[model samples]
Each structure stands twice: as C-alpha cells, then as structure tokens.
Target: INTGAIKSEAASSMEMTELQNTESGEIISGNLHILANSTIDNKGLVNVNQLFIDAETLNNQPDARIYADNATLNTSTLNNNAILAARNNVSISTETLFNNKNAEIVSQGNLQIAGVSIGGALTSAHQVINSGGRIEASGDIAINTDELQNLNAGITTQWVTDSIERIIEVQPEGWAHKYDVSRFPLIHNHNVEGQPFTDENGNIIRYFEDYTYYDYTAKTQSTHIISSAPAKIIAAGNIELKGNVLNSDSQIVAGQKLNISGGSLQNSATPGQKRVSYNGTRQFRDWDGNDEELDFGGIAPYSPAPKNTEFNLGVSLFEDSHADIKSLANIQTMTLPVVNSAMFSLVAKPTKFYIETDPQFLDYRDWLSSDYMLQKLAFDPANTMKRLGDGY
Candidate 1:
C-alpha cells in the first residue's frame, strides 16, 4: 500500500506477507503477529495492542515506527534507527535485535529487552529490568529485574568480589625523558618483581620501576532503590551484565551467579510525600493571620466537590427529608477516579555477584601521561572471580 490505512479483521489471525514496501497511514488493532520475508515500512504510523514478530529479517529505518503496548519479537536480524523511534511499552524479547547506536527505545512503562545482541539504548519512565542476557544503564538509570541465582526477587545488593590490579606498560628509553619523569621517577612495579638495577661499582640501585599501575577497587554508587510498586524478571539461567546496572530500588533473592564487568552498579531513589488537597469549608483569616470558620456555615462541608460535576454523572437515591419546610440539606456530589501514577522496582541475584575492571582498558585513559602515572580504569561491574596476573 502506497498510502492510507489498512485494517484486517479475520476470525483466527491476519497475515501480511510477501510485502516488500509500505508507505504512510497507520494500522491499529488489538493484536499483531508478523512473519518472515515481509517488510512493513510505514511512513506514517503502525500501532498495535500486542505486537509480535518472527521474521527472518526485519528492517526499521529512520522514518519507520512499530508501536505497541506489549511486544515479543524473534527475528534473526533487525534494524531500528528511526528518527522519531517507536513508543513500545511492556516487556520485549528479541533473538538478535540491532538498533542504531544513537536511537533509543522510548517507553513510559516497565521495559525488558533480552536478546542475543542489542545495539541501541533504552529510555524509560519506569525501569530497565533484567530477564536474561546482559544489560547496563549509563547514568540516571532505573533497575528492576526478575530473579536471582538460587534466590528470589527483593535481595539486597551484594558484592561477591572486590580487589585491585596493576596495569603495566613498556615504553622506549627516551619516552620517559620526553615526558619529564621528575614528578614520579619510579613506582613499585608489580610485573617486574625483585629485579634490581646495579651501579658501575656493582652496588645495588633502587628496585622500583617506571611503569604505571591502577587499583581496581570496588566503590558503591548509591545504596538501594525504593519504589511504591514492585517488579520482577525471572530467567532460567545465569544473568550477566557486562555494562552498568543502575537502579532506584528493590529486594532480591539470588538463584545463580550474577556477573558484571567493565561497568558500574548503582541503586538510587528520591522519596517525598505529597500533600492532599482537602475540599472543606472556607476559613476567614484575620489581620493577625488567625483564621476561623465563617458563621454562615451550617455544618462542615461534607462531601468532596467533583473535579468536574457533569462527567461524574450517576444515579443516586435520596433519604428521608425533613418534614418541616424550615429544614435544610440538599446537595449532591460524586467522587471520580483519580490518583493514577507510575512506579518502579528492581531485584536480581546470582550464585555470585562480581564487578571487576579490565586492566587492559587502562590504555584508554591517560596513556600519554608519564612519571608515576595514575591508571584509572573505567567503573565496570564484575560478574566473576578475578585475580591479578601474577597472583594467579
């Protein structure tokens, strides 16, 4: 279809196959299921209630969009790089999802993207929960997961391994002189152990060397995440996160080994109370700031006023009225639905919890520095037992 909309209504299921291209308009329905060897390149919009795709190959371009409240996809390959992107809610599963490194998954509710490989980023109003695979949120991220190794949801953040490593780099002789090594002439070289330098008279010289080292220590970002509602992601196997795991709150029970590396683990939450607006009798304030109920008030205002009186339309029965004409009391009110909000929670456990830094990554930072350089490794969460090269 070049333009306009297409609605398919069949009893069992509807299928759109052998289609290579599609343009404008939107296809909105209750549920959706896409098959392989088909292309749905809608320029306008493509909205569905529950969306599923089992295509061998799927391509989502700069202008394409596939929106749904819940999505479950199993594609061998996918390309989603839309400028506006798709607004997908609920949990999403993929076999091998490839998103634009720049494009992000936009959602207002809980999101779980578990796949063999994921390339894009995720932006949510609720949380990025873990069901399987590995995930990491860069900064200001909210974490909510399903299960833990040998444990259930709502377990405290546990550290399995914490240690430090030294990164050694060998440079040419003139390299030290060019950068001026006066500030840090020598350091305790972890690699070159017990090798001593000698003077012309065979007298022993200083044993320390000139290479730089990094301490891979464990540091907590935030304590724990707190939220009103709870969420969980249960998986059958181990859940490992090679990147950062940032969350606002949760409780967890670990079942297997949970591993992370080359990333940070964070849990944060901002808690506050909301003041309720009361609809009652108005009070008159005196010049001194003291206030009292007006004398005209018969009794205190009883029921709450409708935020909107008309929309609150409903039938009501009246009780016995006052027999005498002088009696008063005749006012109707209704309480409509209000107080809707979004909440998030997270929990994860593994047989072990690990967040270790990669010493090889030290070259990315201050490699040009000289004379007792500080090799600072990027904050990376660990997922396994780590040992210094020589220690093991």
Candidate 2:
C-alpha cells in the first residue's frame, strides 16, 4: 500500500498477512489484526483504535509510526527504530526485543515487556556504547527477562517535557485527522457567544478550529524524570550492562520503591588487574641505640613514634597483592595475638544465623571463613566491621 489511505468503520476489524506501507500510505482502521509468518513491515502511518499483532518478525522503520489506543504484540523478534505509541497500554511478549537508539515505545498508562533479553545481543563481554535503548511511560513499567543486556539504557516511567516551543501546524479541511486536544487541554479566550475574536460587523472571525497552543521554553532537553511513577524490572536470571562507569549514564528509578532482583548484575567486561603499592617513612631505634627515621619513601614521613621507639602506622592496604616497598626501610609493629584470636571467633560464629538459600552457594560459615572473604572484609574501605556492629 502506497500514497493513499484505507479507512474502516469502528464496528469491523481488519486482518492482514503482510502489510507494507510506503510513500506516505495510511491505514485507518477500527482495530488492526495482523498475522504474518515472517515479517510485518511498516514505513508509513498506521492509526487504529486498537491494534493486535502476531508475527515471527516485525520492524518499524525510522520514518514509520504505529499509533493506537492500545497495542499488544506477540512476536519472535522486533526491531523498532521508529515510534510505537499507545494511549492506554503497550504490551509485548517476544523471544528477543531490540529497541535501537532513538527508538521509542511510549505508553500513557502502562508498559510491559516480557522476553529473553532486551537491547543488545547476549554475550560474555560487555558491549561498546553507554546508551541506546529508550523505554518510557507515564504510569508503570514492568519488564521480566532472563538477561537485560542493554548498552547502558535508562528505563524510565516519567512524563516527557518539551525542551523548545514548537510551531503548531494546522491541517486543512477534508483531511482525516485525529484530534489531539483530548490529550492536551487547550487554554484560550473567547467572546460571550462561546466564540473567539469577532469582526466589527458582529461576525465571528475565528482562527484555526483548535487555536495555537503555547509551550514554555525549558532549560534542559532532558525530561523531568526526578519524580517518576512506580516501575519494576525483574531479571529472573542475570543482568549485564555495558559502559556504565558513570551512574547517570544508566539507571532504573521508581517513584516509590524501586524493586530490582536478579541472580547477579555486572558492568565490567574484563577481569580486573590486581596491584598494590605503598610509600611512607618509618621511625625506629637502630642497633647502635640511636633513634633514626627510616624512609619508606612514597608520600611523607611517619610522626610520633610508638612505644620502644617504634612508630604506629595506619596504611590503606590492598589484599590479593603484595605491598611494594619503595625504600629499604625496616618495618615493625606490635601485635596482640589474644585480641586477634578473640575478634575472629566472634566474627565467624555469627555466620550460623544466615541460612543456606541455595545448595550451589557455600554455607554461611564456610563462606565467611574463606580466605578471600576474610581478606576483603579486613581491608574494606567502608569499614564493614563498623557497619556490622551497628546491626546494618
């Protein structure tokens, strides 16, 4: 179908095997029902009161649109590079769904997506870009998938805010146009006869049917996404995000409780390299009974010597790697064996309170006693022991 329009009444629904619209072709139906074995491609306007689609593959080109009051899709694969806007809800159930950069899936009420994966293809290593997928709704958004491996996507349930005041274009008479004033209320001043401005001879001089509306200029292009509605993302298996070193590059926020539960989530694609280095000064008493400052030589010298002419050191140590001593400085520190043994017993005994939720996971006691876990806790920068003692 090309360069024309197909109109239907509200009582009947149209069914098709394959729909290819181009050259500004238009389809206006009460309800559109499409069932294609391979693909249902659209490159023009598709306006329906309601839409239902079941196909193996579907694609909406960059210049195309599929607008409806409500839309429901069941397909194996979908590559939506254009717009899929619904007034009420947009529900999709597929094996794989990839919404490309600049693509949109907008709903005024609810948006739900259930699939194996979203955005990029599943892989072991994280992908390249930080952002690509776009999914937004004014109500709630729910996604249930095994892997949500997007390239730093931001899934939001926020209302869109226009950044600039756009010129309103009014279509001519005899054109089949859907009135958008129902969605956006208009503010205008009219005369006593319930009309707009009038001429000197008492003749009504009206502008376009729906007068021009004004949109205030905004400071930023981004939407006011800070106060959003409730959203849920349940990755039943695992989730992988790429190029998310910065927090703002990728986020999933809810207005109330943002519930996100998955088996695991990761951002780094490569294994981290382990390295540790230290530089400072140490004070000690030499064999000749003379107090001397031994320079370890990284940042500055140690001050206020400890007992027996030894200095107490507070160092930020990194485990899994040996400490690199830059200078040949003799290092010594007093150790309390009794305190160390007592602390370990208390920290390890409390592990029995945690039940083993999965057989694959080690028992709480065994995991807490592991060499890696112990070393990590001891050198944690956030002071894990302090938080634990506070019952956090």
Predicted model with the maximum TM-score = 2
Runs of candidate 1 with Cα error greater than 4 angstroms are 8-12, 38-42, 83-90, 116-392
The TM-score of predicted model 1 comes to 0.30
RMSD list, candidates in order: 33.3, 36.0
Q: What tens-digit string does per-residue lDDT give for candidate 2 at 1-392? A: 44688778563444456667784887777777767767778887777767888887788888577777789887877887766777678877776677666566767667777653346432221221213545656677665555554443432322333333322222213324423323221222222233444333455544333222222221222222231111122122222222222222233434333334543444321111221222233222111112222222233243222212222121111111122444213322223232211012233334332222221111122433333554675755243432232111
lDDT of 2 at 320: 13
| Root-mean-square deviation of candidate 1 | 33.3
143 in model 1: Cα distance from truth in Å? 12
- Tell me the spans in candidate 2 whose CA falls farther than 4 Å from its real position: 115-131, 152-248, 267-392
19 Cα displacement, candidate 2 (Å):
2.0
Candidate 2 TM-score over all chains jointly: 0.41
lDDT of candidate 2 vs native? 0.46
Worst 10 residues of 1 by lDDT: 310-319
lDDT of 1 at 138: 16
Q: In lDDT terms, which candidate is top?
A: 2
